[model samples]
Each structure stands twice: as C-alpha cells, then as structure tokens.
Target: MVVHALHIRPSRPGAWLLGLLALLLMLPAKTPAVEGVEGELRGAHRWSGEVLLSGPVLLSEGASLEIAAGTRVRALAPESSLRVQGVLRVLGTAQAPVVFATPQGWHGLLFERPELPQILRHARFSGAAAAIHAQAAQLVLEAVVFEGCDLALKALREARLEIQGGRFEGNRVGVDLELKSFAEIRDVHFVDNAEAALLATGGCRLNISDCLFQGNGKALSLLQKISGTIHANRFVGNDGALVATRLGAGLDVSGNFFEGNRVALASNTFSQPLVVDNRFVKNETAIASDQFSTGEFRHNLFQGNQSALINTRRADPLVTRNVFERNQVAIFCDFASYPQVRENNFFGNQMAVKLGTYQSAAGARPPGAQREAQAGANGPGPAPTFAEERPLQDFVDVSANWWGADTDLLASLDEQGNSPIFFDRRDEAEVKSQDAFAAGGPIDWVRFRPWLIAPVADAGPR
Candidate 1:
C-alpha cells in the first residue's frame, strides 16, 4: 500500500526559471549546418563551415582569414578562387549574412597585398569573375552584394576602396576603376550593368554620392584622367548616360537625373566636366560636345531632347543657366564650337538655333590633336577626325537668351523675309565683348545680342 510521494515545491524558484525561458522562446529556431571546406589557407584561418571553394585558394603571406556569420561560400567553377595576400576579416551580420556563391563562374575575391584594412561586413557576392578584386589592398565594403559579375568590383593598382551599402546587379562592368583607384561610392545601387555602371580609367578617384544608375550600359565611363564627384545621381534607362572620354577631367556632375538616354551626356578627347544641376529628360542627345570637349553647363534642364546641344570638335562649352525645352534642335553649333551661350532658356524649340555651315560644319579638330595620325607636322589629325565632321564656327554667342521670339522678332526672321526664326547675326556685338577668344572665321555668323523680354523664370522646367 506504499503510495508514491512526489514532493514538488510550489514556490517560485525564479518562477521555474521563467517557465523554462518561455519554453525556450516558443522553440522553433534551428540553424546549424556547417560542413564544407576545401584546401589551402595557411597561418591563422578561422571559418565557420560550408565553404567549398574547390580550387585556387591561396592566402599565404603571414596569412589570416576569418569568416563567420551564417557562412556559405560555394565556388566551384572552371577555376574557383579566393586569392588574398593575407588578412581578410568578414564577420558578416545583417542577420548573419556572408554568402559568396557561384553556379559555374568563379575567380573572385582577390585582394592582393592586404595586411590590414580589409573588412567586408554582411557580404554576398555571386557568380563571379570579379566580384571583388583589389590590387593594392585596403578595402571596407559594408552591406555589400554584387550579383552576376564579370566586373562587379575591380579595383586595380593603388586600391583603397570604401563602398558602403552596395548592390551592383547583373554586372558586366559595375565598378572597374583601373590604375590609381581610390573609390568612396556611397549608398550605391548600379542596376543592370551591361557595360558602364562606372568604368573609370587610369587615374581613378571617384567619390560618387547617393548613387542609383539604372539599366546601365553607360551610366558613367570617364576614361583616362578620371577625377570624379558625380553627386546626387539617378541616371535612368542608360545607353549613353555619361561618357567623358580621354583626359576625363575633374568632374563635378551635380544633381543628376538624365532620363531615357541615348546620349545623356557625352564629351570626348579632352573631357572637362562640371555639368551642374542636371535634369535632361527623354534624351536622344542632351549634350554631346565632341572632340576637344570642354564643360561647365550650369543649371541644366533640357526637356524632351532630340538634340539639345551638339557642339562638335573644339567643343568649348560654357552654356550657362540652361533650360532648352521641347527640343528639336536647341543649339547644335557645329565644329569650331566655342559655346559661351549665356542665360539660356529657348522654349518650344522647333529650331531655336542651328548655325551649321562651315561646309555644313563638322570637321575641325585642332585643339592639340592626337587620336592617331602622327606623320610629320600633325597632318592627318585635324582632318575632321569625326567630331560629327566639325564646322559650325559662324560666330555663335547668343547672349542673354530667351528666344521664344523678340530681338526684333529674331532679326525679322533672319534672311530678312524667311521669318520662322533664323539668325546669321542679330543685334551684333561681334567678337570683342563676350570675352573674345577668336578662331571664328568663315564669314563669322551668330551674335544674337541682348534678347530676353521674358521667360527665364529660373531657367528650368519650361
């Protein structure tokens, strides 16, 4: 008759350990699958499972590699890689992220002389060829994610990156600043990169701000002497979003938003950028400026462009306070271009200005030549090396513009009786007042003086 005496104390023993920690926080959390690794990683390496790189994995040079948080690196291609010349510390944790995938395209993550300063937090590089390849190491990529790469990130020579909040998708050339690297691209998001999401050359030194270059094919391609500052970016539907060629000088492209491009901003040869307050919508040619390219197009905004500024070789731009709406041709000055067209605002353009005819313009390259053609006396270099052929030097100054009509109705419709808006030389001031710098010959045309009885109203949006 011995009854079972179960003595259970009913007193709070810290409430039964807080009810067993709320039943282990309502249990249902299991993440423990780490068993995958492949050879080679000398001296001080610390990994946390699932990392089958299956091939090239060198890291020796007083080595030191460390990857933890939810790691899952699988790179098994025709030539998998991990390179690194020593020291890589990734403790990713944006809810424990640290993936570096590959389906059959790997050869990425290759920092060269890294001894320190290599932190890639919350990383996620995919199918690579260059998901990350620094040369003279010193990286710091936070919240990163460069998908389907071919050149998602290629910082050559003197690398010193610092890309924060990255996300360069479907790459072909997302970020490939060559030679002298020094990036600092913030809040990045270069989508659909098929060519130039950012291809800065030789002397790279970008400082791109709040970026977002969508549908990229040429969202930025400053070559040669690249010195950047692409601020407030948003270059949409690319195809020619930004092209600054050769000597790509100190850019400062401010407040950008050049939409639907086919040629949003293109400079050539001596690319000297500074294009400010940009906003060229529906572009087909919102600024071309060829060959001896020069820039400083202030307060820009050329709507519905079909041609809102072409300027050929000798492209000396300075067109200030811009706003050339409804473009069919807002200003196409041919070669020998010396654009200083001030206070612009030519509305509803069906042809607000053309000035082509130095043999019908396009064939005037003499701003220091050099696109191959060096025999004796720089002969072949100036024969219209193709800046649309070059030849609009018929004087063009177009002062204090407003041009919707007024200036004796555009000099009584230039050609005296052809009145639909023309101009060979209206209210003349010839080459002596607008800080003349001559070269304008061939019967010099286009002077367009003190015009503007209205419509400038802050030079943009009509």
Candidate 2:
C-alpha cells in the first residue's frame, strides 16, 4: 500500500469555499416539480410545492387530500373552487406556511360532510368569495390569515367550526354564521372589515373570546335569535361595535373593552341580550336601543362617553350596578321607554337621566286610517309584553341611585320632596299611572326617588 499524506487548510478563502461545496454535496436537493390539481380526486392524493388549479376541483366521497408545508396554490379563474365532499388536511409548519392565493376572484374552498373532521393550520387565504365555506362540516382552523375576501369564512347549516389564532382583515365580513351554525372563535384579530367582523343570523350560536376587533364597521352583528357568549374582547375604532336585532336573546356579553366607536352597542326590534362587566371609553353613544328591545345592563363602566344609554320606543332595559362617569348624558329614555334604573352611580355627568317623548308626524299615515299605522314615533306597535300595559310597559323606576350628595343638585333636576315624579306633556298633570293607556301609548313618569347618598364602589371587569 502506498502511504498518502492528508492535506488540511486553515484560515483561507479558497478553503472555506471548498468546505461549503462539500457541505452542499452532502445535503439533499429540493424538489422542483409543481403538481397541477384539477378535475376530480377520488383517491388519496398528496400535494406539495407550487400548485396551479387549472380548473374547478372536486374531492369526492372516500377521497382524502393532504397539502404539505411550503405549498402555494393559485386559483386560475373566478369560478374555480375546491369542493371537498371528503376530507382535507393541510399540514403546514409555522416557518413554511401554505398559501391559497386568488389573483382575481374565486369561489374559495367549500367543505361538506358533517361527520368528517378537517384541519387547516398555518394557512393564508386571500381574495376569494369567502376564504373557507363550510356547510354542515366539522372544521378546525388555526393560525390562518384571511385577507381581501368578500367574506373571510362562512359557516352555515349546522356546521361546527373551531377557529383559533387567526387574522381577518380587509374583507367585507370576517366571519358569517347562519342556519344554526355553532362556532367557537378565540384569539382572533379582526381589522378593517367593511361591513361587520362577526355576523350571526338564523339562530346561530357563537362563543367568541379573547379577540381584537379594530377599525371595522361593525364588530359584532346579531340577527334572528342569535345567542352566545362574547367575552374578553377589545373593540376599538368601529362604527358600531355590537348590534343586535330581531328577537336576539340569551346573549352574555361581558369583560369587553370598547373605545372610540360611533356607537358601542345598538339593539333593535325586541332583542334582549345580557350585557355586563364591560368598559366603555370615549364612544359617541355607549348603548342605543329602540323598537321594544330590552336587556339586562349591569356592572358596566361608562367613562368619557357622549351619552351612556338611549332607550327609545318602549325599550325597557334593566340597568343596575353601573358606573357612569364624565358623560354628557347618563341615560335618555324617549318614546315610552320604561327602564328599571337602580343601584347605579352617576358621577360628573351633565345629566343623570332625561325622560320624555317627542311627538312627530313625519312618517305618519293619514289622520284616521287606523292609528296602528302611526303607533310610535320610531316604529310600529311594540312587541306584545307580559306587563299590565302593553304600550307603556311600566314606570321609569329611578330608585336607589347615587347622584352625589348635593340635595341642591337633585332639586335642580326638578325633584320634589324625596321623590320626583314627572308627567308626560300629552297627559293631564293629575295622572300618575299609565296602566290604562292603549297598546302604543306614551309614558308618564320619571320617578326619581329613594336615592342613595353615597357613590357605589367602582367594581367591574376591566
């Protein structure tokens, strides 16, 4: 055997280059071929690298599709959609996320099959009809970014979706829930959606928590008996942060921070939601309700708002244990609203409460063509109530409230003796009860009595 000497070089540019070349030779080469997916998939298929959807794709029953990390799927046209009647699994790492890009517009991904579970994690979807549309499916999406879409995600027809740790921005709507859809959305950032961030209708149930709603038109919009819990969310710089209508009930809204909104909450048309432990700061109107909408408003902090609450058209909310500080108007009741205002602290507000009705005939019908046509100033007849009076439901009970210690200030609010009773301008001065009035009559009193001498403790969720 011939003896061979081993040569080693140290601290030289040419040696470093050679060492790098050797290391490159030891590494595996990356795959370059991009798979094109289209038409129908009936068997299990795996996709990786840059994928181009040549046409609409359908994953039929008993088929499974898996997308690997660092994959980019681009839609070719507006009508292209991925309809999965089977199962889809997108397995993407945090560093190498999967992207579904729509250069123009597309129909987006649609999922069927309620029993099959679908998982999408570390995915980015952009510019489609809706980024993901799930109908009666069980889907879980995590760390997904949806941007510039008509709607970010739509869940319909009794679907169960768990969306966690996502970002929704620059869309018409962030999430749309309809037809008894049940969703649990948490730790999402929704920003600058044009219409609403989260919209639920048609008896949907949603549990939204730990989310941030910023610069959207409406942060939350509920219609048609939507019920859920919304907690620990931040709503900032929206037009109307939360809006409910059409008999929405059984909602628990708590531990929210609202700031710089045109209206923080707007309830209409018999919607009754429980709102508690929320903090409102610098909003134009903290809460505005009309058309017989009523709710339990308790333990809320209203600070630096233009107006705290405005209840109109027989909207009789139960207001209790709230702190209203430095507001222009604490509460304004009009058009026969009968709020049960008790155990609240009103400090540094221009006016604690104003109770009256303004008669208007702008939208009124002809003089004698059925008084039902011109029932209330804001709308038609109130929703039938269980109370004694159907129209003027009850007295405006302003009792056991802290309005500072100055009796002189209380007198300036038109108080008499220990209890101040107000009369409607339309009614005779002698009448105290409005119980005998018709179904859509005006209210008669702002009974300000049995007041508290000291301020209530500042205790509520922040």
Candidate 3:
C-alpha cells in the first residue's frame, strides 16, 4: 500500500524560523493591556504598557509602582481613583508622556501618605474631578498637562505641593490650596479656567512666580491669611487678575505685569498686601481696593487704563511713588474711600483725580482758594475708643504730587469755567445721603495742592 508523503523544501538552516518571524511581523501588534485593574498592588511593580482601570486601586504600603513613559492608563468607570499610599514614581519623558484619560469624570491621583513623597512628571490628565488630590501628602509634579478637569490640583490639610513647568487649561479651578497647605508653583501656564486659576485660603502659604495667567475668570485669589510672594508673573485678558481677602502679614506681590484685565489688583476685607513695581497696562481698573482694606501700593506703573486706581467702601490705602500716564482717570475715589496720594507722577491723564457721587471739592480748591484747619495732617486721625464716636472727616488729602510737565496749568484753574483736568465737588456739590443710618456725606472730596513743579525722581517701578 502506497501512503501519500508530503515533501517540503527548506532553503537553509533556520529558514522556517525566519519565515515564522516574518509571518508574525505581518500580523497586527497588540499592546499588552491590563484590564479591570483594581484592588491592591501587592508588590513592587513597573508598568510599561496600557492599563485599564474599572474601579479604584490602592498601592499597598511599602510597595512601589513605577509607570514608564508612553504608558496609557484609561479609567472605564466614573470616579475611579488611584490611591497612592506608597511610593509611586511615574517618570515620563516629554516625548512620551504618561496619559490618564477618561471620557467620564474620574478622581485622578490621590496621595495620602505624607512620608512617601510620590512624584509624577510629564504626565497628562483629562476629564477628572481633580487631577491630583493630596491630603498631607508630599507631591512633586513637573511638566504635567491637565485639561477638562473640574479642579486640576488640590492640596488640603497641610499637604505640600511643588508644581513646575505645567499647563493647566480649560479647568474650573487650576489649583485649590487650603487648610494650611504649602505650595510653590513656578513657570506654569494657567489659561481659560472657568473660575480662579489659583486660590489659596485657610492660612495657606504660596510662592508663585514666573507664571502666565490668561483668559481666566480670576487669575489668583488669596483669602484669609495667605502668606508668600507672587513675583514676575504675567496676567492678560482676565476678568480679575489678583484679589486678596482678609489680611496676610507678609504677602508680597512684585514685578508682575497685568494687561487688558478688568481689574488688575483688588484688595478687599482688610487685606494689606505689599504691591510693588508692577505694571498695569490697558486695564479697566488697575488697582481697586475696598471694604476697609489698607494696602501699600508703591512704585507701580499704570498706563492707558480707564481708571488707574479706584478706592471705594472706606478703603484707606497708601498710594505713593506710582506713575499714571495717559489714563482716563488716574485716581477715582467714592463711598468714603480715602487713598493718601503723594509722591506720584500723573501725566496726560484726562482727570487726575475724579470724585464720583457723594463728592465735593471740600478739600481741593481753585488756584486762589483758602485752606482749612488741620489740612496739614497727612493721614486720618487714630480710631476712637469703643465708647466714643469717631469724628467726621472734612477733607481728602491728595497733595504733594506732580501733574505732568504742564504743572503750571493747574495754577490757571477757573472755578466757574472748569479746569478740565480734575472732576471733584467743584464740578458737582457733595450729595448728602437721605438715609439717616448712612453716614455718607462729602466722602468723595479730594485735595490736590502743595503740588510738585516737576516729576519725582523716585516715581514709577523700580
């Protein structure tokens, strides 16, 4: 009986193996995917491929997980989180950033251990409730990209966060720091956030510098005893650039540039910030302080703004050595606001000092007007005791200032004809409030006399 035998010809030794490898190469490559990852990572792990998470994951204590560059982590379930209780080193390169994405909203990364000091660099997170949420944890995030998140990063309960060279765009709030936390955010770009780009409250300390904040609702808000320095930042096209609430002892904002914002710097509710050497250009109101706040605005440059400085609601601040050029109104005061304007240079301003509503020329006079009693006093009197009533303020002091190279034109003031330089009670008499409880009378009066012949040498930003 003859059996059919199949004969195959081989070209050379290992030729079949080469053919098999070629066939394998022709097939599609599937990246190794870890599906439905949850529960505890028991031991040290290094993930270099795609990982899909269905629920929450807990990195066990003492276990370390290192995600390599180009790793893609997708969350299938909503609100899923990676809780890092141990060391998690997600080291990604700029060319191959580790990605964490969710179509729905997820929790992103949560760090709870303070001693572990987890770090994530060159990572991208999107569609998260919070991209990084830490409580008393020490975290360092560098070159990260956060987008479409409700809140990009949050530090609570004494958490320490150091973020550098990241981009936070299209988020509700870029950073929320509270509960005595500490953060140093540097060289970051915060753009198109819905709410405040950076907010620090509850006695937190922040050191933010060299950042760019643009097209946001509010660039930065510091509330309730926030201390530290915000230096050399650029704020452009925001509704409000910086707002400080309450008082911080050593809050310094210096060397910043604000352009085209609605309000550049606002001090409210007794906030006393040391704002120095900043440049405000083309803003609606460069500096607006109100609600009994007292701040030191020194050596700032205000140019082409609608109102260079607006003081209202009993805000009493020291305005000195500032340069106001080509502004609509250099200083606008109303509602019992009292800003001591001295040593400033005002050039080409439409109205050097404007008094709106409740205003009068009670203190400011014509070229030959007479002075009043106690006019030499540069500041308001000390607050009366709790039992005694405070005395009424009769005049507002805006003396010792330089009003352009045409300083002598101020001497050619005509009461009936109007000077066209200042708008005060001379233009309209003080409007007394009809409401008995309202203590509004001539709070809008401004006195600009003892004027300087030429511009001050120490004016404008240092």
Candidate 4:
C-alpha cells in the first residue's frame, strides 16, 4: 500500500488489518496513498487526510499553512507547486470542498505575498498551469471552483484580488489582470471561457459586478491601461460582449445585460468609452464603433438588434438618449461613419438610418491604414495617413429623434429633406461617393429636423 508514502501506520495488529483489507480488494481502484510534501515549510503547518505534492513546497518567510475541510492535494509529478511566500489558508466549506488536483499537470498556486493576508474558501482548482498565480499578492477568493485551468487568475505585480462567489469553468483565462493589477469581480460565474472571460491588460483596475458571462469567447477584453467599473453584468451566449481596445482612463459600462451577443459593445483603438445604462437584446451588433472608438452612448436599450449602431473606420459617436426598438437597422453608417444621433426613441425600426456603400473606402482603412504614402506637398495621391485636424462633420446626425411613425407621416419630408428615416446617398447609387457626390448634389442629409413631438420621455433604461 505504498504509492508516495502511505502515511506511516506501522501497527501490525488485528491480524495485520484483516490481511490488509483483502489486499486492498485486489489492487487498483485507482490507487492513492498520500502524505508526502517536500522542501521548506518553516514554522506552522496543518493539512488534512490525503496530501502528496512531492516536489516544490516552499511556504517560508515566517511560515504558516493551513488547509483542512476536505483536503485532497495530489500531484506527485509534473513539477508540483504550492510555493506561497508566507501564510496560506484554504479553509474550504460548502460541503467540504478542498481539492487541488494534478491529472498529469501541475505547477500552480505560487502566491509571493507582499501585503500578505491570503485566503481560499471552498476551493477546487484543477489541472493547473496557473490556477492562482499572484505576485505581490493579497487574495481572498471565496466560493472558488476554477476548473480545467490554464489560467484561472494570474494577477501579477501590484496584485490584489477579492473575487467573490466564483466558478470559472474550462478556463483559458478567467481573470488575468496584469501589471498594476487590482480586481474586484463579484458574484462571478464565467463559464466555457476559451479566450477572455475578463482579460485586462497592463494598468489594470477593474471592479466588475454581478457577473455571469456565459459561453464566452470574449466577455470583457480590455487592453493597455484598462480602468474599471463594469456593473450589473449578464452577457449571454457570447462570441464578443464588452471589448475596450486601447484603454487608458476610467472606464464604465453601466448596468449591462447584452443578450445573444455577436458583438454587443465594442470600441476599438480607444479614445473614449463611457457607454451608459445598457440593455441591448438579441444582438447581432449593438454598439460597435470600430477603429477610432467613441465615447458616451447614453441611456441604452436597443431591442431586438440587427444593427443598432455599427459605425466603421474613423468612427464617430456621441449617440445620446438611446432606445431604438425592434431594430433591423437602427444605425449602420459604415466607412468614416459619423454618429452624433441625439435625444432618442426611434421605435419599431426597420431602417432608421442605414447608409454604407461608398465603396467601403478601400476596406475601411484602419490598422494604421497602410502607411508609407510619401507623395505630397499637397499634390497627387498618398500623403495623409492620419488627418482629421478637428472639423469633418458632414452630416449623419439624426436630430431630435421620436420617429415611431405617423405624425402627418413624419411631417412630410422625403426628397433629401430626409425623414423617411434615411438609408442615404440620396437612397441608392450605393450611397454616394462618385468623387463624393455630383449630379444635383447636396444629399448626405440625415440631420432630421429639430423633431420629436413626444416620446423622448426620458429615453431608455434609465
């Protein structure tokens, strides 16, 4: 009965324990004999029942280690770990849950404490590569259960965590706040993560609330200096929900809901991103503004989306007071898209602003727009890789909103005095760009009058 140690029980009494329980019932129900441990474990220590970890085990710096509840702690191969720099406590509960497996894989849980104070409630980390790897640590994970991990918490440098009510499943990355790390993830439940179920970059400082992101491929991916406060999360069926590409300041994605996501809330190459009171439903695109990202999309609620805001290339957005309902095309405006759409509530939309053609401006030119264009002294082609010295607002600002229909047929407009809710470029010819318009010119007008004789009644979702 000796696998790694067999936990020393030399007593040979009662007929050698009934002939070693009939030779442990004919050997192999997947043999398991714990109690091994290795290297430095200074002052205090206490583990329960089975414990194997046969290689790396340094719990030094004024040492202390306590793990009880239902301790399993296996790992006798794959470079075993558990190197906490000082104290470590894994007081599991909730029906005795404390398992730290190693099914042919190991090396995890290396918390090099700086501010000390560690914790680990109701633990159950599996096959690690990083099931809990902090550096300047200060953990406090409760109700934990990261399964099949590759990285279920890899906080580096200024590490500080407080993850509550956890359950990250099939992790590839369920919490990887780097550099200036600081987390606050609450009521978590991220499931089926392959890439990002919370992957903040460098200057991290998150505070995600009431989380639930399901079937994830993205569910929150903030780059560079990601700042915080993503409240009331729920994102379902994700392929992408909540992207914040080039961040650097205090972020905020208020009261979220995002259903059936394909892209609910993206904001590439950042410049500003506030995105208020969210709710996007049945998404295929709710709020994407790529390349040159935009700010403040106030009081949201786009329902049944097919578009609900797509803005491409040099994307411009200040869309306020939202609530576009029954959308099929609420706002798509592609290349160099402009969007200052104001005070909203365009109900039952089938097409409340669509325009995209203009030949897609050579694939919407983003990603540094193929630089190396040296030809000008204001002459010939090339030269401008990045311009926009401020001015460019050539229309596409759907003024005061409230176009649900029939108010004398939207005050009778059409013929480019637009109010047929626009699809623009004078409704076809592939939406303008014959060198930017000619033949009876003057058309990119979606600047819907100072309209809104009713229904802005405090826009959507508060």
Best by TM-score: 3
Residue 31 lDDT in candidate 1: 51
lDDT against the true structure, each candidate? 0.74, 0.79, 0.83, 0.77
Stronger candidate by lDDT (2 vs 4): 2
Q: For model 4, how does the per-residue alpha-carbon lDDT over 407-429 read when each residue is reduced to its tens digit?
A: 45667765355455576655654
The C-alpha RMSD of each candidate to the native structure, in angstroms, is 13.6, 6.8, 8.3, 16.1
Which numbered prediction scores highest in lDDT against the true structure?
3
TM-score for every candidate vs. truth?
0.42, 0.82, 0.87, 0.38
Alpha-carbon error at 73 in model 2, in Å? Answer: 1.3
Q: Per-residue lDDT tens digits of candidate 3, residues 336-365?
A: 667888999989998888877753323222
Write one digit per residue (lDDT tens) for candidate 1, span 42-140: 889777756676677788777898999878877666376788888889888888898876764677778887768889898888667777788888899
Error of 2 at 4 (Å): 18
Candidate 2, residue 459: Cα displacement in angstroms equals: 5.6
lDDT of 2 by residue, 1-462 (tens): 333333548756588677666666666677764655689999898889888887889999889999999888887786778999988999887999999877656888989763689999999988888778899999999999999998889989999989999799999999998999999999999999999998889989889999999999999988899888999999999999998998557989999999999999998999898999999999999999898788999999999999889987668789988988888878887655667888888777876666554321111112232343345434766633333322222346687888764434565664433222223332422323332233333434456666787777753443
Candidate 3 lDDT at 269 equals: 83
Model 3 pairs whose backbones collide: 360-425, 361-425
User: What are the clashing pairs of model 4?
Assistant: none
Q: Give the TM-score of candidate 1.
A: 0.42
Number of clashes recorded per candidate? 10, 0, 2, 0
> What's model 4's overall lDDT?
0.77
